[model samples]
Target: MTSQFEYGSISSLQEIQRLGEIIQQCFGGSPNDWERYLNRIGAENFRVLRQGERAIAGLGIYHMGQWYGGKILSMAGIAAVGVPPEDRGKGIAYELLSRAIEELYQLGVPISVLYPATQALYRKVGYEQGGSFCRWELSVASIWLQERNLSIYPVSPINYTIFEDIYNQQAQVNNGNLVRHRAIWEQVLEPPKEEAIYAYLIGSENEPEGYIIFTQNREKQESAIEIRDWAILTASAAKRLWTFLGDHRSQIGKISWRGSPFDPFLLLLPEQTAKIIDRMNWMLRIIDVPSALSKRGYPMGLEAELHLEVRDDLLAANNGKFCLSVSEGRGEVTKGGKGTFQIDIRSLASLYTGFLTPQQLQLLDRLKATQEDLETARLLFSGSHPWMADFF
Candidate 1:
């Protein structure tokens, strides 16, 4: 282990294959199929930590443009980080992460996010906790069955365009929402060995209003169905969809859904035994201020202008503030004279994801604001708990 190590980019096809092989051996499974994974890394987003001519570690960054409230800009996502078993505990992973993060910063990537394998490691590397996604399980009989005027039909690939349009519209209006790109849709809708997948579209007056994606698992000799993603544009549509799931109570021993932490199901099912098995889902980082704020809907009939000082340890540019003025569901941002409230970019991200409240941030010493300023920040950023069922 005395060999001198050099850190740099790895792009050649042969080199990437070598890195993939090392990752497979380290993780006990193959990484994404070679060609697709490489394409995802693109030409410029892969990094390597090498010992002489041998690649000991590899990391990939996926650039995504997302709207946080209203601002839209490229955000960096760290994925597929791996190091050879022999290289573990040798600081190889840390070396690769540091390099990758710095490169993203240099490239103007304001926010970097990852689903951590170990929370402590990323926290040590300057990442902070954001949101928790709750995976809930309930008996099919848990929901009250109600007759609906809507019709339900199996969802197909042909409906993806409409499904996406509806989902994006809803997600944009909701806080703690992540903009799902086309690539994400493709992956989620077509996971491997997914023959048991099922989908249903709820239609009102012959127009689609909601959709549900689920999969049935019979491998355990128990009838269970897992709802992967579900969205409804109206209360009626939501009721119709739930009724459909409930109608199958005899065939379904248990019904599970991956949903936001604040999903009303828990309240909706009082007598049934329901569990929040998986607590956290997607982590968020604020890549752009104006864009992030503008995309989400705000509480009605409240208007305020506050200067925000956001401290980003990794990306320095997110530290400045523009004034945030909100009236009704509309908001405006302008270059302000000075900020009243002080907080870090991570704190802002936490607030954006509904994982941490302004009050909680204050308690953690992550927020720097006076009483009035704190109230203003709370009014602007506060909402129900945010959760993302999908993991990027």
Candidate 2:
């Protein structure tokens, strides 16, 4: 517990080998996986916490972005947060997180998000649960696909633009969704030799509004379709897509969908043949309060003016009163105002992302506001409950 932890990027193959073994022991990965990962993302993007020459914990910093308030905000997606079993109960994770967040803010990332294995450490570090990554399993026959004049065509990697266009359209209306980097799409279009994924587009050949990518696996004469990524522009298109999924019912016993947290598949099902299989909540932290507020998209018709007293423990620059004025669906955040109520970085993130409304936060004692202020904040921060479809 009293060990002097040194925090920095991994420097050598020996350190990479050591970190990989620790990862295998802690989270299960190949001993040499770190070497390959470092090669892909570069050594500087990965960090480690060491005592002397021994690594105790490590994490990777992914330069990512997410859709929030109708705009894409730069995000630091924390990945591979691992601590050796023997290193647990120590402060290594806290130390590593502190360094990672500081670096993210310095790099001008307005927000940092991650899928937390546990809420305690992240909450203590000023992160809050934002939205869930949900998956559902259903019998292929259960899908009620409404037949329409739908032209669905298979898409080849050569036509990546159509797929990206549809995906981009979906991300816009959904808060906390990812604004994927082109490198990711490049990989998707040209998956590794060991990967099997397929894509398709719907609508006119020149104008595709919906897309789906899926992978299949078989077991003992039964087959399952795992939807990798998909998006639709209309309910009719969605129904048409489901109809396409239903086409495999003769061969596919089940289909698993990892889509919007608010997926209406259940409502679309004529019968109760689907089950909620899994759900995982992703955490988000506000790195720069003013920046996050100003950059996020808001309801264009919403007009409001408010004051807030924000408190940030790790970032002193965010610890002060902020004046938030909104008009014509845009917002401006400044540094002075008679704060109506106070909120910490953690709680503020929840409210800012629409994961929790002002009333809910006040009831939880996370947001301090009266009836009027709460209503104003509610209107100012109103939007869909943020959900991230991507897992970092």
Candidate 3:
């Protein structure tokens, strides 16, 4: 295991095929399946660590944005990090991730987030649990609602812009929802392989209030409805969509969708029959602290100033004291401060999303700050619980 390693982007199809084998071995997908996935995401985004001509570890970077405080912040979604079994426990993951994160910082990405297979390796690179991706399931038979106050109409690829408009309208008010990339949009709007996807508008085409993109999974033995993406901008639209889903109770037994822990749609249910069937916590790494602080939206008309002493072991530029001045729902970061609040970059990810309050991190010994600073930090980052309806 003393051979030299090269770390960089994949340059050839041979490298991709080799990396695809590693991915197939690590994750349980056929190489051709991964090849199609790689093609969809684009080969330019894939990076690898190589020993001679063979790729031992690799990962993919997806360019996207995350909504926070009514604004969209640029974020790199990291995915498909894989390594050969023989290469495990040799610091290969750490090396690949560190190089990839540095590359992101060099490219001026403000932050990077990933759905981690393991936290230890990501944590080593200053990534911490930033938000949640939860899958909720409800028995279709229990929906019991047939309200059709709003008109429902089928939407085709030609009018997919309606989905974007409706989704953005809902996303601006929530935290951590994706401002999806074109690749993600293509994946959502297009049917996969042999399966078919259905898209519909919840209101009239002239002024659509919401949209739903879903698929019906019916096998010989079982059937279920899987919602790919959805947004309800009005109460009537929500009722209509639920009724439409309930209409499928005759063939679909369960309906599952990705949503937040406290998804507002669940509140519309008359009873608590829906349950969280699956959940995954995604991690975030702040690549450029100042850009991250200045780019994200803040509470309007609330003026405040907070001094932070942040520590970043991986990125030197982020390791220092900084002052954040907020006004008109925007922040300006300047170097030098009283350093009243102290935290590491990893913990800041959680605070940045308002996923964890300053006090909670203080209690967990993840950060240290005085009571006054803690309250100020809380207000500076206050918002809905950070969660994503989409998983990268």
Candidate 4:
């Protein structure tokens, strides 16, 4: 029996254009703009489910890495998922994602992450909420700091490498932040159409401790500042950056940026005036279970063992008993265990990043574990709160 639909890498520009139209139909973006984006991402990075030459569903895959426990783990970033209105009920999205993760596993991508358009569909494929992407808003007038002790300089295109270095240094200490791909950097440095982006380094030229990249939007009587990205390595840097932003109080109404829930920059603020305007939970899937466990960093000097029976309906390789031994700030996985603690792959995704504790998962009825095991699991995965400043 021949299946009605075929799945493969998008083979031609015409198929790419058709996929762009399908995405536009689902996401409400200009087809031409999406077409250009698809071209830039390259046909090789996309997979589609097709009925003959017409694509019914599709998504793009980005090869990237994410930070966890101060280590970089290989990750697949899924984006642009789309299914035409008429094909919504046919299980195309599930089949497409199912095939994608299987391929990712074969390619040694230990994990996958995505910002979902809807959570239910991803849950079916063993993905769960793993971390937060929070949007913070602060009234420009609220920042009254006037510290100019550290010199600030405008960064030219040639000085962009410093920005990359500073960001990686900060990402190392945080969980779930991206080890950004070059494509992401391109988007960061490129100014929007008819708008300008300013990049600056704070502190002395020889030893810059922080950087800020932002764009100003002036709409007649109202104006705002959008922080594209920033990082601070010193106490004075935070105050200096805030002072620079406060300088725009006369013109900029508010400043907004996507960041972690426990952003250290907030600690330097004189008052708690910064409000979280938006919050998003990004999902993660353990594509290759043992590899995922081994690649992630564990808490140093705290050694313990967890016996897990992970259930995965789609990936048989992950559906078995395993022993996770943690030592020297790393984990090693082996087959066969008591299977004392049991959880499906979805619940494990959340626990893997420390986004939710084993206790919380049990409270939600997402897992079955003893109080003793829960405490052991908690110590093994404990770290900074999992959050990302990047979107997709």
Q: Which candidate achieves the best TM-score against the true structure?
A: 4
List, residue by residue over 1-392, the lDDT tens digit for candidate 1: 32466777885777788877876675556456655666745736678888878788887776665444444446677777888776688777777776676666666565666787777666655666766667787777677667578888876554456577677766654444556655566655764565556777888536678888877877477788877677878777777877888888888888887766667645444364677777755556665566556655566777877777767665555567777778875677776537768877767878765567788889998888888877877777766665556665
RMSD of candidates 1 onward, in order: 3.8, 2.6, 2.0, 1.7
State how far residue 169 of model 4 sits from its true place (Å): 0.5
TM-scores of all candidate predictions against the true structure: 0.82, 0.91, 0.95, 0.96
Q: In model 2, which residue pairs have backbone atoms overlapping below 3 Å? A: 69-297, 300-329
Please write out the lDDT profile of model 4 over residues 1-392, one tens digit for every residue.
12877888988878887888888888887866786667657678989988877878899887889999989999999998999898888788988998898899889899999999899999999899999999999999989999999999998763457698889988899999899876677667666665788889998888789999988886557799889889888889999999999999887899999898878888778899999989989999999889999889998898899999999998999999999999999899999999988999999999999999999999999889888899999998889999988875
Candidate 1 Cα outliers beyond 4 Å, as residue runs: 1-9, 31-45, 51-53, 65-67, 70-74, 156-159, 191-194, 204-206, 265-273, 286-302, 316-340
Task: Give a tens-digit lDDT track for model 3, residues 1-392.
Answer: 32577888889878888888888888887867797788878999999998787788998889999988888889999988999989899888988888888888999999999998889889999999999999998999888887988889887653456688888899889888888877777666656566788888888878988888888887557798888889999989999999999999888999888889998877788899999989988999999999999999999988999999999998999999999999999999999999989999999999999889999999999998999999999999999999988766
Model 4: CA > 4 A from native: 158-160
Off by over 4 Å in 3: 1-4, 157-162, 190-193, 219-222
Give lDDT per model, in order: 0.69, 0.80, 0.88, 0.88
Off by over 4 Å in 2: 1-3, 31-36, 146-148, 157-162, 182-195, 219-221, 265-267
**Candidate 1 TM-score to native:** 0.82
Which scores greater on lDDT, model 1 or model 2? 2
Better of 1 and 4 by TM-score: 4
Deviation (Å) of 327 in candidate 1 = 6.6
Model 4's TM-score against the true structure: 0.96
